[model samples]
Target: MNDTAYTELVMVREFKVSPEKLFDAWIDPVMMRKWLMSMEATNKSASSDPRVGGLWEIIDVRGGKEYRAVGRYLEIDRPIKLVFTFQMPQFSEFEDTITVNIKATEEGCKMVFTQHIRVPVEENWTDEDTRRAVEEFHDSSQHGWHYMFVGLKMLAEEGITPVMPPASE
Candidate 1:
């Protein structure tokens, strides 16, 4: 981990909803199922343990294959802040830490989300190659996060009710 080059990705968004409502969208499994996965994902499901050190996971199907977002909670400060470890095992072996800070505003709330990514460069790669790789990785990740945030915003502002899947026998 010491040798890894960490990249920080930060995003901020304001919502027209109470801090508690916005924060609840992150920890509650049903809300997570609706907003945590990529926009193209389907059959999304989530399970959570929101206390510090508790593990949470969300799985979504895309093209008939599953992609997961798994994490362990590191900090939980109610409607104010949350810190967790985020991992996508199907994509990479490295883990990242995500911090989400929320503050109440006159109209609603503002959220600052940050992800610290552990980007490992191969020794044999040229500097230009390393730069390109990291940029591409971050770009894709940022795009995905933007999509998820759109869903969050919709959930907050429009109260879009998620159509939950039927119970499996």
Candidate 2:
């Protein structure tokens, strides 16, 4: 009966690091730039305000094209959970919500990452069209998150943070 189409993609990752450390990697701008930037990206920058209602932004340059993502923190429970809104303006105007739940474990921590994407329903589109759109978006978003998680796992286990670049004059 809902007019809008929405889907939730859930992913789980366990890391060999404490919950606090893993949680920081999610909000810390410098650490985010290191891992969130795709391997092919040559230049990347990130800025964040790690508080509820705060805003965050990241920009990555690949082949001289900039890909930017912006978000606002909706909920923040340090070392435990975080919920935020994520959107890439250049790609789509629709905003998606992402929730990260972290729990301490014997070895380290477990993270349950869930992304909720809501696609607006257009009057002109058929049911089949809406289904395909949701499926395609869900698959691509899952793949992207999987790639980012690989980097996050490496960063968390390594325990060595990457140095920040020198500021331009």
Candidate 3:
């Protein structure tokens, strides 16, 4: 068995908002919940402190089961960049880092998310295996992030929140 495993996935999205406002939403839990929650019907599953060495925790419930990701903030540069660790409590074996970069464009904001996953060598690391894993993560994350941004745009334009279906429903 191999001793280590690694994978990287990157996703990008453009939003019709200024970089500063978009950046603030990323760091502020209150604002983050408006878009980050898995279910639009509920509030954020947990809280996060957007500072170096701070903790980020979220408890998401689906089908009456709870899922969590707990980690520490490694870097936080407002309106520009953020890097943090990610861990799953259930498996306890998956630990990773996620970095978000925000750049301002003439028309709006360009946000890029990069997720790095490191796994045990026992886990399959074939080319196909790696490609599938990264593709899955990239697809799911892109969808979620796009949804979040859409919700954010609606909030910004109308001062109203968008509703999403519950995972249970």
Candidate 4:
């Protein structure tokens, strides 16, 4: 519960679509499934109610395994902002808060996404291995989000659904 255990990841992207369209792509399962999740994820479902306190979940099937993220909405401001709690279904102890802000531009719209996550570091927080693991986790998290956001922009702006990568053999 020390301040040193928290992690914050932020990403911003501009799209050739309005805030409304970009926002809808986030809460509508039909549009979301077209872009969300890794390229290898299949049989995916993104169900959500775009209102405060409503629950949302994303489930994806990969190689006969199901992975899911379930969360509850905290705020919904159409075409502008949304805040929510995000968590993995199997990892009750690990949860994060995500906030997305959208602003309209003469050209299109801009989105700023922020996720604040807390990692549970053991009592000896100064250990080298633990520090390295945390660093690696942050790097991977940043990389993953950047990749996914590109897909989202493509879907929203171009109406192009990127093909899902084939499942591994």
Candidate 5:
């Protein structure tokens, strides 16, 4: 199957901080490395220009495997919106676009994060094993982002850093 498809995933979460504070964490490299990674991963580094047309790269060591996400900022509006393109070098076959919109509330803020990603299915690579692997990768990415969202909320709200293996346990 030469089937090509792009999947969109949306994750919404509320933060106990202002929109500006929550948005800043995503652009500031210092705060980014602290919460933009999966709990199971240790951040190797996060560096970004954080302006329109600027590029960013985040390296994380997950499951003892190095995972790299490189992207460019397409749009930026402080405390409001941010749009970026995401790509994984190892999976150069796929591409992703991410949009983050923040709305300030009486207490804090609500963030609507959307990711539109190309679902990778290489031509002539259709087999039971290959199909399973592709599905697993998609699900893994979904969970990773949701986990990062929780970590971000904690960092912005209670100033608590998410330690590996989850602190609640």
Candidate 6:
């Protein structure tokens, strides 16, 4: 039986804000923390530099377990496109790349995020495992982005930044 794995998950969302604002929220650490840390079970800390070749790291803690993701920016086109690599410390050998594209439209901004996973042939990869992992990742990614956009739209419209939950809370 062949045991090679490859898959891509794509999610698109429309935000009721300008592309510039949406892009800023994504790349800015302060704004990112607001939405990225919304989950009740998780604590997130991130450091990001938005230029090409810049570095980023996100640490998530849940149930006394920690997961760290490190990545480097590959391309940055302000308010339009961003490409970066994503890898988990525990799964360092498995590196994935994600591309985000934002476009201005008549109503708002259309944001598309695509994650590409490349699994080595030696992992004895199975279709069931791949599908489950991809589905879970895609769902979580979409939820986080949607939450962030909600906060962004609130800020853009009300001119008030939403309060983020306290880390210990």
Model 4, span 113-150: residue lDDT tens: 99887666766566775667577667777786776787
lDDT of 6 by residue, 123-149 (tens): 665667767766666666556556655
For candidate 6, the C-alpha RMSD (Å) to the true structure equals: 5.0
Candidate 1 residue lDDT tens string, 1-169 = 2245667899999999999999999899878877787432373679899999999999888778888989999999999999999999988789999999999999999999999888877877777877887787788778878877887887778977434321222
Residue clash pairs of candidate 6: none
Off by over 4 Å in 3: 119-160, 165-169
TM-score winner between 4 and 5, please give it.
Answer: 4
TM of each candidate vs. truth: 0.90, 0.88, 0.76, 0.86, 0.84, 0.71
lDDT of 3 by residue, 1-169 (tens): 5555566767787777788887777667766666664534555366887779999776766667777768889988888998988887696566788898989888788989888866545455777776665666556655665666577766654555677632321
Model 5 misplacement above 4 A: 1-3, 39-41, 124-138, 165-169
Best by the TM-score measure = 1
Q: Where does model 2 exceed 4 Å of error?
A: 1-3, 37-43, 159-169
**Worst ten in a row by lDDT for model 5:** 160-169
Query: In model 6, what is the error at residue 165, expressed in angstroms?
Result: 11
- Badly placed stretches (over 4 Å) of model 6 are 1-4, 37-44, 120-169
lDDT at 141, model 5: 74
CA-lDDT, candidates in order? 0.83, 0.83, 0.71, 0.78, 0.81, 0.70
C-alpha displacement of 82 in model 2, angstroms? 0.5
Which prediction has more favorable lDDT, 4 or 6? 4
If both were scored by lDDT, which would come out higher, candidate 2 or candidate 3?
2
Task: Give Cα distance to truth, residue 12, candidate 5, Å.
Answer: 0.9
Candidate 4: misplaced stretches above 4 Å?
1-4, 39-43, 124-127, 165-169
Candidate 3 collision pairs: none
